[model samples]
Each structure stands twice: as structure tokens, then as C-alpha cells.
Target: MDRKDISEKYKWDLSFLYKDNQQWERDFERVKSLTNQIKQYKNKLGNDSETLLEVLNLQFTILRNIGNLYCFAKMKKDEDNNNSMYQGLTDRAEMLMTEVDMALSFIVPEILNISKDTMEDYLNLDQFSIYRHYLEQVMKKKPHILSASEESLLARTGEIANGPQNIYTMLNNADIKFPKVIDEEGNEVEITHGRFIPLMESKDRRVRKDTFKGLYDVYSQFKHTIASTLSTEVKKNVFYSRARKYNSSLEAALFQNDIPVKVYENLIETISSNLDPMHKYVSLRKEILGYEELHMYDLYTPIVEGIDLKIDYEEAKDTVVEALKPLGEDYINVVKKAFDSRWIDVYENKGKRSGAYSWGTYDSPPYILLNYHKTLDNMFTIAHEMGHSMHSYLSNKNQPYIYSGYSIFVAEVASTVNETLLTDYLLKNTDDIQIKKYILNHYLEQFRATVYRQTMFAEFEKIIHEKVEQGEPLTADNLSNIYKDLNIKYYGKDIFIDEEISVEWARIPHFYYNFYVYQYATGFSAAIALSQGIINGDKESRDAYIEFLSSGSSDYPINVLKKAGVDMTKKTPIEECVRLFNNSVDEMKNMMLTK
Candidate 1:
């Protein structure tokens, strides 16, 4: 069905953000003017506590306004990417944002210029209470904060630094096209990034192989181009790491959220050691599917067939709300509000962007976009994105703007917790053996995708960045060879490592995301621990999880998870995830044997 055919009740009301484009224009201009005002306090941040507080307040106001402006334009453009007017608005908003960033670049250096004793005094002032955490975060960067001139220069390079990612997005989403392949039903279907997964899950091996090859065929055509773009992105990360005096790009990336480097290292060390569960799952797949060998294309096909668990959008909404009831009455109420109110764009339209994301500013309602296909996976996606929306809603309500936005390190925890809860609810409530098997497979796949797969990506990221740091050139062959070796190690000798999988790195947009994929592995592990606690109905655990959601950037991400009773610094969480994966595999093996 076309998006326009969807009811107004199902579509998100972006009008809630701005009554019209005119209002958005007004906000854009106001933000532009406010950027000029930021210069007024350029050198006066440490004049006194009052001056510091005022500057902080002004900076927050300007940023908050820009957030709303950018959110509106970007959301509109995402609604229909073909709309040139909205696209232009998004471009202008992005440019204005870079300008605002450059204008406020001095604020950090100026704050760092103050003596620690005086900074503490200012933080203790009643007027500065709200910004205490924010100020302390600035102080943490004291060692890395450069002179104002250099800071401004770095900020100005922001747009240019985004060039690689922008190019990849255009090439992947807008420019590239996949060929048509015959599906299991003998119908010819065109492949897309959206349809690629579903196609891989096809019962017909012919379909899966065709879609996989067809998809990669296009990616292979431009491997060199994509390789160059990824290389540039890595080089950009290397540049900032050196400039900030960090030991490596990984350290610099993790430092932004104050995440310890050991967290990344621990995830790799632990997952690499725990590849037994992964190998076992692979063997189980090979045994159940009656395949002598498993290929990359065979990884996604269901082991137990004949169980159709497709869910429509309405059912998905109800399932999510019901599954999240363990969160408490107030949380359920907000989920209900999201369903009833126009807080989500519920269907795909022509030119609408692919995939799903929860996005909004402090000033606007938390919004979600989904090209929801009435499948079990899409149901989990609804639950996942709503987790993010609710986290934002609670944080924005509980804290001021400065502390409202959570770091990406902790962001995945909330979403994964929701998914975990949904899985548990499905398994407990269903009596049918087939249904149980399907849900169990889903849970196992989540671990494989989030923990094992992402860790592999993290290791790949680490290797590439280290190579670049050591002044090695990143050619297509060099990148592909490194990725192919990691694939062999992670998946083990049980499965065939197709040569086509070598260029798979060329297609993952996350390679350009700068040490970001590791968080998925860590966050998934943390969510497993948190979800287990929440499901136990322990008020203390529930309250702590809620508090973690509300905490946002008020504390370091590692410390925040620790407060929620999950010590990410320790190896316990990843070990717990590994144990869970093993347990699930055992259960699946038993179920299949009995059947």
C-alpha cells in the first residue's frame, strides 16, 4: 500500500513540530541571528559565575532552537526525499548548524581556561546547578581543548568532514540499483536495501543466492569508489585523534562519551574467546537445514519452517504496548499515547527514506519513522524504536536540555531492552511449539546479529583505523582482505567464506561511523542484564532502569549503566550474553530433536 493511502490517524503529525514551513523558516532565521549573539560572550565565560551561567543559558537556547529547526527540515526531507523544497531546507538548516557550531566553539576552550578551583565554585553556584554536569563534561576535555582559533578551525571543517558519509549515502541509497530476482513464489522481485533481508530469509535457496549475489554485484561494481569513501572517513577520524592528542581513533571516539577504551577491548577479547556458541549455532543450522555446508546466504533462512508469524501494523502496536507493560503503568500510558497520537510515520511512501529511526529534539514530541511490513521482525523494530522514543520522552521531561540527549553508547540499551522484553513476553505467552521455536530463533538471531556480528564489525573497524594510524594506505584489496580474514575467524571453519563476502565491508555504512558499532555489542549485553532484572519485577531494578533512562548525559555512559546495576567495565555482561546464547542454542537443539 502507498503511504498516501494510509489513514491520517496512522501517519505522524509533523505539524506538531512546526505549524507550517513558514514557522520552520522563522525558527531557522532566529537560530541564525542567535549564532551572532554567541560571539558576545566569546572571551567572557570565566568573568564570573553569573557570566558563565548566562553564556551557558544562551548557548543552550541557541542549540535548542537549531535542534528544532534541523529536526523539522530533516524530517520533512525524509518524508519524501524527492521533495526539492524540503531538501533545500534541510541543506540550509545543516549549513546554519555548522555555523552555530563554529560560533560556539570558543565556549568550551574558554570554560577550560578557568582554574579548576574557580570552575568548581561556579558549578556550586545555585544559578549553575542545572548545568553542573554539562560544565564538568567540558572540564573533562580540558586536556584536549585547543586554542580558540584552532577550535574554530576544527568546527569549520565539520561540513567537509561529513563529505565521505554524504557521498556513501547518496551512492548507496539514491544512485545504486539492484537487479530483479525470482522469489520462492516464482514472482520476480526487485532487490533493495530494505528487501534484501527478507529475500535472504526466503525458504528457496535459489532466491537467497540470487538476491545476495545481485545485491553484492552492484556493490562490487563500485568497490573502489566505496573503498575510497571509507578510507577518507578513516583518515578523518585519524586526523581528529591526532589533533585531540588521543592514542588512536578508537580512543578519541570513545572519549566523547567518556567510555573507557577497555570496554571496546573487552568486547573483542570476550567475543573472540566465546566463538564456540557461534560455531555451535552454525552447526545447528547446518544439521537442521540438512545442508552439508552453510553459506553466508543461508545464515538468515529459518531453520523451522511452516510457522507464519507475520503481524500487521495494528497488531504490532498492541503487541509492543502489551510487551512493555512490565515497565509499569506510566510507561504503558506513554506507549498508548504514541499509538493514539500521531507520534509515528507508520508506512512507506514513494521516495521516503528506508529503515527506521526514533528522532526528535527536546522541544518536539519524540517521533519514529518505519517502513513497517507486517512481519514479526517489523514488530520487534516497532518495540525497539519505541524504546528510544520513550527514553527521549522521559529524559526530556526529567532533565534540562543540556542533559536531555543521551550518548550513543547508552542509546542502544533502551531499544534492545524493549526487544528483549518483547521476546520474553512472546515466549512465555505462547503455548504452540512452532511459535516457541520461531520466537527462540528470533532471540538467537538477535544475539548473532547484535553481539557476534557487531563485534566482528568493531574488530574490522579497529584494524582499519590502526592500519591508517600506522600510515598504511587503504586500497580496496587491503580493506577486503582484512574483512575476509575477520569473517573466517568469527564464523569459524564450519561455514564457507564466500569471496563475495570480502567486499561486504564496502556496503556497510557503519564503517564510516567512527568506532560506533562496538556500542551495539556492549549495549546489547547490558540490555540482556537490565531486561532480566526488569522482568523479575524487582521494584529496585525497575526504578533503576527508569532512572538510567532519565539520566541521559548527566553522567558518563559506563557510570550510568553501573548505576542501573550493569557494570560495563567488567566482563560479566558479555559473559552473561554468551551464556544466554548458549542456553538458547541448547534449548533449540532439544526442541528440534524431540520434533
Candidate 2:
């Protein structure tokens, strides 16, 4: 399992980024020199359009180089964590980046200080077109930008602001431990967050119930303490929002990407109005398991068991290519290039990174690092990451360096679209009823977890933050009650909402993320709608989707999605997604009943 033992093709060829370490060293030195030189423009940003444009150009160059250096060194370290050389390089790169950040701290604040008419005049310049959006974003934050002393004071309070999340992390990861439970084999297994979900999927009902109760029972014991942590977290958000002059914590959180509060409202309102499908899915789970009443713990177990498909790397590649044919030949050929060329590090090796991500510089190939094992989930991971890499590849090909990176708001859309297409292709191609049934169930789970579940989390966050904004206290009992009510509303009457489930919010780390869970639902909803149009072979829709992928941050994230076939500002995408979920439930119900 050592990295040295892996075949050359199975590993990433980082030479695409740099021919050798010497090239990387040369670039590192170049960045250092540029960092030292960039300070010359620190006070001259408001001098004129020419100087401002020049400074912007130089700034991006330094950033691009630093990005390459950090990405390369970190990826090398990821390939083998025990490699000391790359570790040193990564440290050095990180330090240099810090220095560069310090050196360039004046860029944005000074840009904001410029008069709006002057900034507009600069944006109208021919050479400033590429940096137009970048400058506009700076101007957009002008109202929120504070005085230097005030900003410094707020910056100093960052650690205090982050205390809640840090405390929650230590508690969840290190402090609290779940009691030992009897696993499926009658062996005593200590329950932990890492093993909770897989244990809940155990075929033995006793194991599922024990793990579920065991995990939540520990959370229940810490309910009051965690409620305080979450309350303080909410208070911290409210403080920052009020300090920054935003109307609410939710608005402040969404404002970074220029997302309006209406988008958040649309997500909650649309999904709430369309909960019948989610309820039906839950009801069908009770019927499928033949249970008098399905407990919350029973949800993770496979509805159609005995259909574990073992796919190899080769088969997964072929299947991914076939599934993605709807996107166009160009996209397919690039994925093929990723496979044939060394654009992917495809397997697990000793000390390699655990999960998969697509990373590269603007100049480097859109490289993927995957710890791929040949399970169905792993196959889907390939398609999912391929979606991200392709998005990067297309954007890097199409846009300038300044505008080449897209927002997190639309990032999940590409990956999930790939997943949706793959699921559709598999269902259509497979005649085996068992495999068909499994895929259908998998589709239903995707909607349940990504769309419905995340929307519920988003709604909870909104409610808690709203209460804090309105000066209401968040007691342990009230928090638990709010969570339990939402659980009942989301899962419906067929499943029992256990008392222990009320404390579930005590353990969720996302609650401290300040309104971050809603993007998952919105992005998933948009992907389903876009993927459905592409699957129907609508040429205009397919091309627009491709164009959306190629568009990085050239426009606002919402406008970027709007340019694509789906509009997140309206309720259409979420409704379209729920419709698909309903049809899939019907198909899956018929399949499960017939067999």
C-alpha cells in the first residue's frame, strides 16, 4: 500500500503543474520577489485607472503563483503524508502566502476608498474589463466595510467569534464518547460519530436501534452545554450582522455571494409546500420494512437488500463515460483525457488523503485525488468528482485568471448533476430488477438527504437565528423542541420521532456554520432540474448548461445559475426536483411491491 508500490498511471503526474521541483522552487522565489515588489503600489491604488489596473494585474499574478505553489506542495503531501520534503514545502508555501497576504492587505480596503464614479470610470476602461467584476465586488462591500480601527478591532475578535465552533468540534470529536453497543455480530462496539451511520445501516434491527439511541443519549446528556454553545454562536452571528449593518444574520451570510434573502426564503417556502413526496417516501419505508411503526433509526437500512454491485475501476470509468454522454462529446473526451493522461490519482496508498477533491492551478491540469475503492459509492464518486474537474477545466479554458474560479453556491450543482445523470443512465440501462430497485432507492435517498434533510436543517438555522435576532433566549428545552417539531414535520406520521432525536441538534456541527446548509438544498434542486433537461436531449438546455460550467465567477452566482436552464430565484427548480422525487417513489414502490 506504499505510494512507491502503486503503478505510475494510478498516481497523479504533478509534472503537469511543474516539470520538476526546480521549477516549483523557481516559481516560489518569483512569488517572494513579487510579494516584496507589490508593496510599492500599496498607497497608490487610488492614483489613477492605469495604476489601479496595473496593481490588479500584478496582484492576480502573485496570487496565481502562490495558488500553484500551495496546491502542488499540498497535493504532493496528500499523496503520502509521511513525505517530509513535501511537508516542508507546504509549510514554506503557507508561510509565504501569509506574508503575501500581509503585504497585499491594502489592496481591497484602498480599492473601497476610491470614489464610486472614479471606480466606474476605471471599470469602463478597455484593460479593466477582466478585472471589472473583481473591482465591482470590492465596491459592493463598501457599505459594509468599516473604518480601519473598527475593522482591526473586529478582526481581533475573530478567535472569540470562532470559539463556539471550536468548542463544538472538540466536544464532538474528542470529549464526549458514546456508550458501547451490541453490533450486528453480537460483539460490543463502541459507538462514535464516524461509525454511527454505518452502524445504523446494519441489517440487525437491534444494532440500528442501539446505535441510534446510544449516540443520541450521549448528546442528550450535553444538551444544556451545547445549547449554550449554539446560542452563543447565534449571538456571535447576530452581533456581526448588526455591526456590519445587515438586516439579519441570514442576509449577512448570503451577502458574500451577492445572494438575496429572497433566495433563502424561496428554498424554504418551496420545499415546505412540497413535503408530501418526502412524507410519502417515509411512509413507504414503513411499508417496505413491514414494521408496525418505523422508528427514526430504521431509515438508514436498505429497502431492497441483497443487491450489492461490485464494480471495478475499469467498469466504473466506462459507465461514467456512458452516463455523461448527454453533456456532449467535448465533455466526454475531457473525462477520457483525465483517465488516459495522468490527470487523476485514482487509488488508496499508504498515508494518502482519505477523500476525493478536484484541485489545480489556473495553468495546471484540473487534477483529481481520489482514494477510489471499487464500490458503487466509489463509482458514483468518480462521476461526482469528474463533474467538479470538468467544471474547473472548462472554466479555466474559457475565462481569464481573475474570473476563473466559481462560487461555492454553484459548485455542488456540477457534481450533483453528474450524479443525477449517472443514476438516470444506470436505471435505464439495467434490466435487472434488483439493481433497478437499488438505484431507485439510492435516488430517493439522495433527495431525502441532500434536498429535504438539508432544507430542514436550513429552516432550523433560520428559526434559531431569527429568535436570537428578536432577543429570545435559546434554552436547551426550546432548541430540542424546535428540532423535534421540524423532524416530525419533515418525516411525517409514519415514523416515530424519538425523544432522543430531539437532542440531535446538539451534535450537528453545521449549526455553527451560520446559515450554510441551505446551499446544499438549492444546489441539489438546481442540478436535478438541469440534469433532467439534458437527459431529455434538449440541445439548447444542454448547451446552456455547458456554458454555465464554463462561466466561473464572471457573473453573480445566482445569475450564473439563471444563465443555465434553472432559476434559483423562483420555486420552479425545487418543485421540478420534488416532482422527480415523487415519480421515482412511485416507480420504486411499484418495483418493490412487484418483487
Among all candidates shown, the one with the greatest TM-score? 1
lDDT comparing candidate 1 with the true structure = 0.90
The predictions' CA RMSDs to the true structure, in order, are: 1.3, 4.1
Q: Could you give candidate 2's per-residue lDDT for residues 418-454 as a string of tens digits? A: 9999998999998888888888887788899899999
Backbone clash pairs for candidate 1 read: none
TM-score of model 2 (CA atoms): 0.85
Question: Candidate 1 residues 11-128, lDDT tens each?
Answer: 8898888999988888888888889987888888878888887888889899899889889998988887778898799889888888998999999999888998998877777887
User: For model 1, what is the error of residue 396's alpha carbon versus the real structure, in angstroms, after optimal superposition?
Assistant: 0.7
Clashes of 1: 0
